[model samples]
Target chain A: MSRHRARRSGLLRAVLSLGLLVGVGVSGTMAYWTDQATVTTGQLAAGRLDLTLNGQLAGPGGSTTDTTFAVGDLVPGESFARAISVGNAGTVPLDYTAVSHTNGTLGPGLRWTVVAGGAASNAGSSANGDRTGTCTGGTTTFSSASAISANAAAPTPVVPARRPLAAGASETLCVIVRLDPSAPSSLQGATATATFVVNGVQRGAP
Target chain B: MSRLRVVVLNAGALLGVLCVLVAAALWVTGSRPLVVQSDSMAPEIHAGDLLLARSIPAADLEVGDVVSVVDGSGVRVTHRIIEVSESGAERIVRLRGDANAVADPDAYTLSRAERVTWVLPGVGSAAAFVDSTPGRVTAIGIVAGCWLAVVLPRRRAPLHARPRRRRGIAPVLVGAALLLPAVLPGARAWAIFDDTATVATAPLAAHRVVAQGQPQCRNEGGLFGVGEYVRLTWPHVDVRYEYRWEARHTATGEVVRSGVVQPAGGRPGELELRSSVLDLGLGATTYDVVVHARLRAAPSWEAAGTTTQVRTSAVLLGLGVRCA
Candidate 1:
C-alpha cells in the first residue's frame, strides 16, 4: 500500500509540474505576440522634384542676360545668337516635351529657320509679319536657329529647341536671330516670346 | 490526518498554481492591452479604454468587424473593418473608426498572426502602472521572496492542527507568480510569416489647390462643392499635393489627358487658386479623375507637443466637359 501511494503521489506531482510549466510558457508567448501585433511595416512611398536653370544670352547691342536678350538698330544682314540651357534637378531622369510660340513677323528679308543636327526642323510664318520655329535636338548643339533679314517685310522669331533632360543632366541650345538692314527699321523693337514645358512621368518601383 | 483535509488542501494549492501558470503563459505570448490616450476612437472606446486585441488570420475578418491594428507609426488602434481583401494567399483588412468619416491612411494586413485577445476594460491603467520602473522592481522582489519561501525549510506542524492545512500552498504561490508577469504591460512578441511581395504601379496625377481654413471640396457631376472641413490642426506642417486628371469617353471607356499637376507652394497655409483642367482632345465627354494624395509629416518628438507637424491626405475630385 505504501509503495502504491508513493507512486501515485509522484505521478501527480509530475503532471502538475508539467502543466504549470506549459501554462507559463503559453502565457508569456501570448504577451509577446500581442506586442508584436502592434507593430506596423514601413514602406517607401514618396517622390520629389528639383529644378535648376542655367544659360546666358548674347545679342547685337552687347546686351546679355540669363537666357534673355534685347537688340535695337541692327543694320540689315546683322544676326545675333545666344545660348540657353535647361537642366534636370530631380533624382529621376525626365522625359520632357518643350513647345515654343512666337507672335512676330516673317517676310522675304526677314525669316526664321531651325536646324537639328540629327533631328527635323519646323518653321511657320504668321500673316501678322511674325514667324515661329520649333526643332528637336540631341546632345552637342541639338538645334540651332538662323535669322537672316535685311530690309525684311516683317520681324522673324526664332524657334527654341525642345529635348529630353536626363536626371541631374543639362542640355544647351543656340538661338540666333537675323535682321535685314534693307528691312524697314519700323520693325525694330519687335519682341518674340518663348516658353518651355518640362514634363515628368512617374515610374513605379521594380 | 483526515483524507478530506489533505485532498482539499492539495486541490486549493493546485488551483492557485494553475492560475499563476495561465497568467505566465499570457505574458510570454504578449497578449496584453496598452492604454489608448487619444479621442480618435471616442464613443466606441474612450481614451482610457483598455483595448484587448489580437492579430489573427486576416481572411477570417469581414467588413464591419471591430479589430485592433497597427498604423504607419506602429501605433495600435481598435477600429472597424470596412474592407477585406485577399491578394493571392495574403489577406488585408481596411479599417475605419465610427468617429472617422473616411477609412484609415492605409490597410491593416495580417502579414503574421500575433494579435490581441481580450480587452479588460479598466485594466489598462493597472497594466500601465506595472510597466513602470518602480512597479517592475516591486514585482521582481515579490517573485524572489516567493522563491525563497519555497526553498527554505519549515518546521513540521502537528498532524491534527488546523494551521497545517495550508502546507500545500507553495504550488499556489508559484502559479500566482507566473500570472503576474503575463498581465504586466509593455510585453512584445512577433509572428513569423511571408513578406509583402506585390507592388502596384500607377501614374502621378494633377495637383489641386485647396483653400486653407475652409472645408474640403468635393466633386459632383463636374462641379466642386464645399464639404467638411479638414485641416492639419498640428502646427508648422506644410501639405504637399499631387493629382491626376483623367477624362473618360463615357460611352467607350476611353481614357484621355492624364493631366499631372506639380504645384509651387511649400507653406503651412492655403495659397493660390490652381485648376486641374482635363483636355478633352476631340469629343465632348464626362470624366472622373480620382486623386490620391499622400501626406508625410515630419514632427520632432519633443516638438510634437509644440508646432511644426506635417499632415497629408488624398482627395478625389471630378470634372465634366464637352468637346465639339
Candidate 2:
C-alpha cells in the first residue's frame, strides 16, 4: 500500500508539473494582451489670414465708376471720390494694410487720401463709372497713395495701419483721389494706371 | 535490457523527477508572484513572466535592482531603480526601464516594496488563465477527482493497512499550488474576468500652457480669448492615444466647436496636450469645453473627464478695436 501510494503521488506530481509547464509555455507563446490602437488621420489645418478688396466710385449726380476707371477726357484739377469696402472673407480674425502700386506713369500726379469706417452704400455700382460716395463714418485716415514706380515689384503700405478685420467682417472706407491742378504740358494724355494692394495678416500675428 | 529502450526510459524518468521537484519547490515557497503585464521590462523580463517579489526596506534598496511599484492609477508595474534620495526620515526613489531610453515620468515615494527575489519565466500567462472562470472550474474538478483517488483506496484497505502521513499532505500541497495566485494582491487585476472592465479617474485636465510642436495664435490676448486644449495623460503603457474635445453651448449643450486630437507614442505621466485655436474661437457665446480619452484596448479603456466654461467677447475689425 505504501509503495502504491508513493508511486501514485509521484506520478500525480509529475503530471501536474508537466501540465503547468506546457500550459505556461503555450500561454507565453500566445502572448494575447499587448495591443495598440491607431488613431484615424486628423489634421488641424491652420486658419487662413486673407481679405478681399471691393470698391466703387461716384462722380457728379451720384455717377458710379469701377476700380479701373477712365476719367474720360482728364483735365487739370479733375478729381474722383470712391467708397471702397474691404471684406474679411476668411476664417481667422485679421488686420489689413492697403498699399498703392503702379507699373505705369499715372500714379505720380494722382493724389489719394483714405478715411475708413463709413456706412455701406448701394447708391453706386462697383462696376460703373460713378466715383462719388455718401459715407460719413470714422475720420481715421487710412493711407496716402505713392508716386509712380515704373516696373515696381513691391507694394509698400501708404500708412502702416493694421485695421482689425474679424472673420466675415467688412470695412467701408471713404477714398478721395484728385489730379494735380498745376500740371506740366508734358503730362497731357498720360495714362496712369494704379493698382491698390490690400494685404491682410491674422490679428496678433504681426 | 535493450540499450535504446533503457536510455529512453531513463531520460523520461529524469525529466519527470525534475518537473515534480520544481513544482513542489514553487508550491512550498509561498512566494507571491506578480505577472509581467507589459513589454516595459522586456528582454530582462518579457511579458507574461511570473515574478516572485517581496518588500525590502527602501533604505536597503540599491540602484540597478529591478522592482515593481504601483502608480497613482493603481496599476502594477516593474522597472529598474536608478536613483535614491535620502533626506532626514524621507527616502525618494527614481526608476527606469531597461527597454526604455528615458526614465519614468514621476518619482516614487520611498515607502513601497520594490525589490524582486525570483522570476519564473512565462508562467504568468498560465497562472492568469487558471485564475479565469473556465480555468477555475477545471482546476476544481481535477482537485476533487484526485482527492477521491486518494480516499477511495484508503477506505477499501485492511484494518492493519494504514494511510501514510506524507500521502495525506500530498493532495493538500497540490491544492495550495493551484490556488496560490488567487490569494495575492495586485495579481487580481491581471486575472481574466467576464466583463474585463476597469474603473479609472478622470483622464483629462484643462491647461493654458503651450504644448510643443503646436501652433500658437497671437490675437488671443485681446477680445478673441486664447485657451489651451484639455490635456490627457496616463500613468502606464506607452502607446499612441486618441481623444476628442468640443466646445458646446452651456445652456443648451449644443456643440459649438469640436475636433479630435491624437499624439504619438508617450510614456507614463506624459501629457498629450492638443488644442486648436480655430476650435477655441468661441465668439461672444459662453460655452463649456468637454473632452475625454479613448484607450480602445481590446474591450476599450475609457474615462469621463471634467468640463470647462469659457466666454469670448466682441470685436470690431474695421475700427481695429476689441471690446471687453
lDDT of 1 by residue, B1-324 (tens): 235333433433353355355455445664554454333344565443455555566666667767665555544556667787887556688766564433454776675433445554544444444444454454444343333333343345566756422233355456546544334343422111000011111111111122223213322232342221222221122233333333444456566444433334553322111123344233223433333222211011011011111111123433233111
lDDT of 2 at A100: 55
lDDT of 1 by residue, A1-206 (tens): 23344334434433343443343344345446544433221211122223343421111011122433333323344444444454455554543323233334422333333332323232432211222223445343322233333222322223223344566676544444455434443343344333322222222110
TM-scores vs. true structure, each candidate: 0.30, 0.29
- Candidate 2's DockQ is 0.01
Candidate 2 chain B, poorest ten consecutive residues by summed lDDT: B192-201
Q: Poorest 10 consecutive residues of model 1 chain B by lDDT? A: B192-201
Q: List, residue by residue over A1-206, the lDDT tens digit for candidate 2.
A: 36575557544543443444433333233223221211111211134334555521211011122433334333334455555666676666767666655444445655665677755332433222122434467665644444534343654454357677788888876655554554443444456555555555445431
CA lDDT of each prediction against the hidden true structure = 0.38, 0.46
Off by over 4 Å in 1: A1-206, B1-19, B23-39, B42-44, B47-54, B109-117, B150-324
Q: Residues B1-324, candidate 2: write the lDDT tens digits.
A: 122322222232333333344444444763345665544455677656677766667777778887767666554557888998885555677776665433564777866464678776666665565544455454444434444443443333356745534543344455545555432211411210000001111111111111222212222232332332323333333232344567676768878667655555554322322333323344555556565553322112233544555554434431111111
Judged by lDDT against the true structure, how good is candidate 1?
Answer: 0.38
Q: Which ten residues in a row have the lowest lDDT in candidate 1 chain A?
A: A55-64
- Candidate 2: CAPRI quality band: incorrect
Q: Which segments of candidate 2 are over 4 A away from where they belong? A: A1-206, B1-31, B150-324
